[model samples]
Target: MRFLSLIWSNLKRKKLRTSLTILSIVVAFVLFGLLCSLKEAFTAGVNMAGADRLIVRHKISLIMDLPFTYGSRIERIPGVAAAVHWTWFNGIYQNEPKNFFGSFPVEPEPFLSMHPEYVVAEDQKQKWLQTRTGAVVGRTLAQRFEWEIGDRVPLTSPIWPRENEEAWEFDIVGIYDGAKKSTDTSGFFFRYDYFDEARARGEGQVGWYVVRVEDADRVAEVAQKIDDEFANSPYETKTEPEGAFAQGFVQQIGDIATMLVAILSAVFFTILLVAGNTMAQAVRERTEELGVLKAMGFTDGLVLVLVLAESCLIASVGGLIGLGLAWLATAGGSPAPSILPVFYFPVPDMLIGVAIVVALGVVTGIFPALQAMRLQIAVALRRHA
Candidate 1:
């Protein structure tokens, strides 16, 4: 405790050099934190997907449509509890692409029933089912646009333009909240029947089917049965766990996890060199002072401890600031949904950063501490004179 100030003062001896070195460490860890958060965000969908659910999509590609009637067939399969279908609705709101969110045309009854995670008032649910052009939105989506019940929301789709290419209007009938942490309340759902009736093309087809299994452990068996049932057909089906399905979409861009690891590895390697050089230079400049302390009865081990403490203080301070900034930038509710819709700094990531800081301090201090420990008082005093 008494030597804490001494260690800090030694670190501050070359103020500009120490500051620049700490800044470099801060930059490295900031990149590390942001990259780790991004990797987690990319896979968040998979982590949050329902364990008892499976997704059935076109075997050839996700973009290809499946017959809407497939939902009925999937429901009949053993171990299958319920199935609901949805098609992608890429609607531009009020001529702005930035107002983007997930818009799906779905079967109102089965879709809402299957997703009991979405809490909707019974009266609102009934209204959404009864009104032909009615839509239901998630709580987050409603808040984003300040939409309330009975608001007329207009959307235009290049894929399914209306007569004379005008926007399609929908009456918002319900707002739903997530019953679970995994649920994403950032989307819109409308009646598939209305979309089918008014669409320019691709009628009687659905984007995909979400199947809930009777037992979570039976998901793989149910998925296999669904695929076998649709095998060799015109639209041979592919069935996968809900998590795997979400991860597959992320994998389409590239291997993000691997890329992030590689990037961080390079960053930390550079930090190690910079931090190591700073420690070595600091010990060289303080050689005489270290010898005087030794003469005053500081043991070799004590000298080692002092050098290591200085290294740790620099690493810990810079690493914490970097991590704090990263969290504020992405996790503190900045509304850039397109990029970081599900991003937040996880506790495990912070723990990992802390471990890295400690390890970096120890590694950079080793040789320098050894040098200080081996210094002879008589030789150090001679060199100083």
Candidate 2:
């Protein structure tokens, strides 16, 4: 701590150069925070997927429709506790594409039963059940549109236009939240019966079935059994664990998790070189001064500590500022609900950022500090002469 002023003063000698180096570090850490959060958003579904659940979809493609009756057969399978179906509505709000959010039609009771993570009031649940055209939305979705209980929301769908070709209106009966921080709460769900009866075509069809296994340990066994039950049938089934299903959905946009990792690796590698260069140059410029310090009886170890401390200070200051900004950016909520629903910076990742700050400080400073420490008073002075 006594040498802090000396280390700081050395940095102040070339104010602009020091500022630029710090700025580079600031950008690197900022990208670290935001990229990790983005990857989390893409993979949250898979991470929070139910341990005892399986997803049954069409064998060929997700876009292909599956028979809704498959849910009943799936529930009847051994080790299967319950099954529910959800169909994507692709509903648009206020006729605007940007106001897009995930809209699905599902069996109300069974879906709520299957996904216990969606926290909703009991009375609101009852309200949703009683009303034929009732809809429930996540708290995030409700807040985004300023929707209240009993508010009528009109949505149109190009995929399944109503027989009457009129706007499909739903009365908001409930606002649900997530049980976990990573749970998605930006979807709108309504009763499937109304949707089936009202749509022009594709009646008695479902997008997929979520089957809750009676024995979580036997989930894979039951999944295989369910798939075999429909093999060679007109509508073959492909069954997998809930996590794999969610992961498949994410992969449709490309292997984003791997891509994020590769990008971050490249970013950090570049930053490491830039920071190393800055420290190396700083030390070289101060070669004569370092010799003078040694002549004044400053120990080699003390000089090394001082130089390392300076590098760490630069890293710590810029890194902390960048991370703070990233935290604040995510604190409010998802900036784009339509694209990324779950936006949260996990604590583990934040802690990793802190660790990176310390490591960055040490790694960038070590070479320069070592060179400064090995300098001989006479040789360094003569070289500077």
Candidate 3:
């Protein structure tokens, strides 16, 4: 501790230089923290998806429609407990065009039964089931639009446009909160019957089917069986675990997780150069001082420790500042999920931020410390300024 203080005081002797070096480290680490957070956020939905659920989508392409009858066939398969079919409405609010949130046409009763994770009032569920045009909004979506039960919200569809119509209206029957933190809390789910009855065409089609398996461990076998059943059919099926299905959705936006990792690696490498250069410069400027210490009976190990301590101090200061900034950014509210719903930073990401900082401190200090320790007192003293 006492030796560290000496090294710190020496660093303070050139306050501007030390501060600049620390600032460089801080910038690099802040970027590292942000990148790591982004990687976690992009894959967050997959991490949150349950193991017991499986998704059945069009085998050729996810965008292709599947027959609604597949839902009943899937439910009858052994190890399948329940199933619900839904289609992405892809609707907009008013004509603003910028307003975006998920809108899905689902069978209210069976959908709710399959996904009990969405908590809603029992009376609200009954009301939603009874009224064909009734809709349910996620908690986040409700807060964003300031929607309440009984409110008639108008939505304009791009995919299923009404003939020269401005919008379609639906009554909000409930606001649902997710039982789990990972539940997508920003979307609208309404009765498929309402949509089907309103549309003049495309009556018996669905986007995908979500199946709840009897046992989580049997998901793979059941998925294979489901695929095999539809293999020779006109509308073949692609079966995946719920997590993989969610991940496939994320992949459409490009490999965000891989991009973040690459960015983080670059930032860490930049920090390594910045810290290493600072330490190397400090050692060069204090060559005479190190020589004098060696002559005065200070061992090479002690000199190395002193130089390494200086680097550690600089890195620690920067690391803490970066960590503090990261915490503030994440705590304020996640920007990723707001702008891109599929991404969200988790707690493990924060831990990784701290770990990266600690690792940077050690890596940036070791090489310079080694160079300083190997200096020969006699040769160093003989060298001209």
TM-score, per-candidate, Cα-based? 0.90, 0.95, 0.86
The root-mean-square deviation over C-alpha atoms between each candidate and the true structure, in angstroms, is 2.5, 1.7, 3.1
Query: Considering every candidate listed, which one attains the maximal TM-score?
Result: 2
lDDT of 1 by residue, 18-132 (tens): 9999999999888888887777777878777889999999999888999988988988999999999878888778789887778899988898778778888999999998999
Q: How many steric overlaps are in each model, in order? A: 0, 0, 1
lDDT of each: 0.87, 0.91, 0.81
Candidate 3: which stretches are off by over 4 Å? 121-127, 130-132, 148-150, 162-166, 179-181, 291-301, 334-339, 342-344, 374-385
Give me candidate 2's TM-score against the actual structure: 0.95
Decoy 1 TM-score against native: 0.90
Better of 1 and 3 by lDDT: 1
Sort order, TM-score high to low: 2, 1, 3
Error (Å) of candidate 3 at residue 88 is 0.4
lDDT of 3 by residue, 1-385 (tens): 7676678778887889888888887777667666666665666678777799999999998779999999889988999998899798887886677776789999887888888778889999999989888999988777777889999998988787654454778999999987865567777999888787776567789999999999999999999999998998999999999999989878988888677777777877877888888888888888888888899999989988888778777888998797777666665445643455433345676677667666777787788788879999987798734
Residue pairs of candidate 1 with colliding backbone atoms: none
Off by over 4 Å in 2: 383-385
Q: CA shift at 186, candidate 2, in angstroms?
A: 1.1
Indicate whether candidate 1 or candidate 2 has the larger TM-score. Answer: 2
What lDDT is reached at residue 96 by model 2?
96
